[model samples]
Structure formats: structure tokens, C-alpha cells
Target: MKIALFATCIVDAMYPEVAQATVTILRRLGHEIVFPSGQTCCGQMHINSGKFAQAEPVIAAHARAFSDTDWDVAVAPAASCVASLGHQQPMVARRMGNDALAAEAADIAGQTYELSQLLTDVLGITDAAADLGSYFPHRVTYHPSCHGMRLLRLGDRQSDLLRSVEGIDYVDLPLADACCGFGGTFSVKNPEVSSAMLADKIRTVHSTGAEVCTGGDASCLLHMGGGLSRFQRTGSFEGTPDVTAVHVRQTSSTDVGDDNVDHLTAVVGADDDDHLTPGEKGTSPAEPSRIQSGFRVGQSAVHLARILASTKEDPLRVQSEGATVSGGSLR
Candidate 1:
């Protein structure tokens, strides 16, 4: 299959690794990956901010970019962007009385899929460890972004794939379906409300005791990561920034850090057999221990693909940037 990559603005500028990793996954599956050079933002920010007039050109550009390319499917790693493509783009075009653009936008939206949706539904990949050789020896909790959950109704597609990864201890995040409060301009225009929502999300993540928090949207991840960074500094709810922000870093296996001696040894580089429960060892089952969660978010397709790729070359580890936990940095 020939796949065209719709590298969203956040992933392109801030999180390029996620885009590259996406290519890695598709190539490993023996599929061709094409990047349409004319691509830009899907105009989600403009549409969300109630600027339909300004968004038409963006939506038209998106449709034109893909229409000019020859590909079987167009996929993006971010669900929010995918949601905008399907839910917002055509609506915006029609609102602006661009019937031709509306039809084109609708056609493009039909062919677009979120990374997880493509992998699971179209590619029929049921086991990440077995199919993709995914290995990450860290406890992980997943956050399903609002657009993916409520709008797209992705419904556990991301979490299910993560759960199937080899050597991974998957924990259930409390209120996993709640928004990270990164609704594009909503975060900017409603700082106090956004922070309160983020605080609730961060608290739930902290409860899971997992080292990594992942989701389908880079924007939400950026919001949550910044909140974690600021909360660690101020030590209280002091102020809020009514503006959008993002930080990105290139990460490899070595960035997981050496200071976490016990956790590093226990989870990282462990064999598949090491994950077996006591019941499987001919012993009485021990009571289940609750895992505390952290503030990691938005690994997207590349991050997920590299986890599998690491199993073949280097073992996967966490980085202190781009969705780092509390007391960690995102750059």
C-alpha cells in the first residue's frame, strides 16, 4: 500500500521524530510512505477560534495537497488533526459558501485516518509486540485525547495497542477519557478553566504511578507537559498562560537516564519471561498493586514505532522532554 503522510504542524515543527517514526512503522510493514510537500496546518486553530473565513484557504490547501498526490491512504499521527479533517474542515468550507471546497474537504476527510486507527482497523495489527516487535520495559498509562475519544470515537484503539506491547506494564489511567484541556484556542482563551482541567488530569496521571503518559494528540501532550513543568516550579496554582505553547526534542534510547537505578534495571531491558505473574510461576497470585502514573504524553506514531524498533536494536526508554513527567523537562 502507498501511504501519504499528513505531517501535522505540531508534529512537523515541534515533534518531527513522531513523523519519522511513523515512516519507520509503515516501511517495516512493507508499505511505501509518501510526503506531500504542499501540506500545512489543517486550519484547526482558525476554525476552533471561530474564524471560518480564515480557515478556508487552509482547508483548501490541505485538499489540494492530497489531491495532487498519488496515494492509497493519507494518515496523520494526531487524532485532533484527524478530527478536524473529518469533522471541522468540510463544515468550515460549507459555512464559507465554498461548495466545491466542501466536497473536496469531505473527500479528503474520508480517506484520512489516525495512526492507531490505520494500524488496527486497516492493517489488522492486533499485537504490537508480535506484529511490530514493540518492546518497552516501563509501566505506561494512556490518555485518550478529547477529539479522538469524543469526536472520532476511537475508543481504546490506542490503549489496546499499547497494552499488547512486549515487556510493557500497562496501567489503567483514572478518567482516561477526560480532556487534557488543550482544545487549541480554548486553552488560550480560558486559562483558569484550562488549568483546572489540566490539574485534574495531572492528578489522575500521578495516581497511576506509571513512568510514561501517552496519547494520540501532540497538542494535548504539550499542554499537559507544560503544566507539569510549571507546577513543579511554582509549587502552587499561581498563574496561567492564556496562550498556546509547545516544546520538542529528539530522543533516542539513551535518554531514559541512569539516575533511576532500581526502575532502570527492573523494567528496562527485561526479557518477556520476566513479565510473567506469580500465578504463572506455580505460586499463589499476589494481590494486584496499584501503579502511580506520571505526566508523560503524546508519543504518537514515531514514538510508538521506535518502541518496537528498539526491541530489534536498542531497548526503549523514556526521555525528559516532549511529554515528560512531573519534575522533568520537555526540551
Candidate 2:
């Protein structure tokens, strides 16, 4: 399979490791990976921000990049970006009175896949451990990003893969399908509502007591991670340095458990006030943190294919899986 890797703008700019992991996993599966450099933002930010006119070229760039490529499928680690390709791109094109561009955008989106969609739907991969040697000995809770869950309709494809990872304690999250409020520009435009939603999410994450929170989109992870960082900063969250968020952006495919797991350690235990940059981390001192202690925060990506592609033995032990509690239990 010749797969064109559409490293979304966020992944390209902030989380390049995720793109590398995506490539590493596909290559391990004996598939060739293609990088279409012409690709840029999927125009999701512009469309979401009501800048339809500005989004036209971004949509054009994405379509043109994929149009120039001769690959079986185009894949992105972020579900929101992939969803934008299919959902927003065409709408923006039509709104701009560019029917041809709309048709082109639709064609491009039809061939693109979020990582889990490509792995499970296209490649017939189900069990990460049996098929990819995915081994992560940690308590994990999954938060399905809004776009992936509602827009892309990915269902349990991502979580099912994580559940299948060797030595993984996959716990169910309360409101697993709820939005993390990182609607690209939506968070920036509406900070209070965004912060409220984030507080609820962090509270639920704390209830799970999972060492890490895994999701399908880097943007959401960034939002959730920012909320967690602020909670840690103001001494709001009273947890240990173990809980972190892992955006299965390509998942543990590169080194399965080790790299992402190690990355999580860095994210959660980071205490340098300098590390708590406001805009970059997606947090602010104005927002009150309700997350308790023994629940630090971090972020990473784990590739599903690489979890089963390796020849190494499975290292998971299925420790007590923590269930995400919401509502009354939250502080």
C-alpha cells in the first residue's frame, strides 16, 4: 500500500514525532509512505473561525497536494484534520462559489483516512498486541475527540486498538464521546466555556486515575493537556506525576510503548514554571483549576500498527482498569 502521509499543520508544527510514528508504523507493515509537501492546514481553522474566504487557498493546497500524488490512501494522525478534509473543505468551497473546488475537495476527502480508520477499516487490523506487539503496562483511559466521534464516526476503532495492546489496562471513560472544547479557534474565541468544558474533562480524567489519557486528535490533547498543566501549576490538581494524555496520533507504532510512555513521563512531571507558557500550552492563570492531586498531566502519541508489527513479546499485565467517573464525583 502506498500511503500519502498528510501531517496536519498542528502535527507538522508541534508534534512532528506523531507523523514520524505514522510513517514508522506503515513502513513496518511493509507499506510505502509518501510525503506530499504541498499539504498544509486542512483549512479547518479558517472554516471553524468563519474565515471562509481565507480558507479557500488552504483547501486548494491540500487538494492539489493529494491530486499530485498517486497513492492508494492519504492518512492523517489527527481526526479533526481528516474530518475537515471531508466535512468542512467541501462546504467552504461551495460557500465560496467554487463548485469545481468543492467537488475536488470531496474527492480528496473520500480517499483520506484517520490512522485508526486506515488500520482497522482498510488493513483489517484489530488486535494491537496480536498483530502489532503493542505493549504498554499502564492504566489508560480514552477520550474520543468530538470530530472523530461525531463527524468522522470512528466509533471504537481507536479505543479497541488500545484495548488490544499488550499489558494495557483499558478503562472506559465517562462521556468518552464528549467534546474536549478544542474546536480549533473555538477555544480561543470562547475561553470561559472552553475552560468550563476542560475543567469537566480533567475532573473526569482524574476520577479514572489512569496514568495516561489517550485520544485520536492532537488538538484536543493539547487543549486537555493545557488544562491539566494549569491545574498542576496553581496546585489545583493534587495528584502524582503519573497521569498524562497520549494522542494516539499514530499511536505506539514507532516503538510501541517505550517512546510515548517516556514522553508521557516528561509531560506529567514537568514543573518548571517556564514550561507553563500561557498561549502555547493553551492555559491561563485566570482559569481556576479543579483537578486534584496525585493526578499530574502529560501528552504523547502511540501508533497502533507498530504495537503489533514488532516481533517482541507482549509486556502488558492488565492491571486494575480505572473507569472514568463524571458528574457528582467531580470536584
Give the winner by lDDT: 1
Question: How much lDDT does each candidate structure score?
Answer: 0.72, 0.69
Can you give the lDDT of residue 175 in candidate 2? Answer: 62
* Residue range with the least summed lDDT across 10 consecutive positions in model 2: 322-331
* lDDT (Cα, tens digit) per residue for candidate 1, span 82-147: 999989998988899999999999998999999999999999988988888778877777788888
Q: Tell me the deviation in Å of residue 255 in model 1.
A: 44
Q: Can you give the lDDT of residue 212 in candidate 2?
A: 64
Q: Compose the digit string of candidate 2's lDDT tens values, residues 1-331.
A: 8999999998787656567767876876789998987888898888887899999999999889889888988899988888988889998999899999999999989999999999999999887777765677677778888888888999889988888877777778766666776788888898777776776676567656676676777788777767665654564533322224332223475675664322211133223333444766633222222242235344222333233333345232221233321211110
Tell how far residue 269 is off in model 1, in angstroms. 39
Local error of candidate 1 at residue 324 (angstroms)? 9.1
lDDT of 2: 0.69
C-alpha RMSD for every candidate: 13.0, 13.3
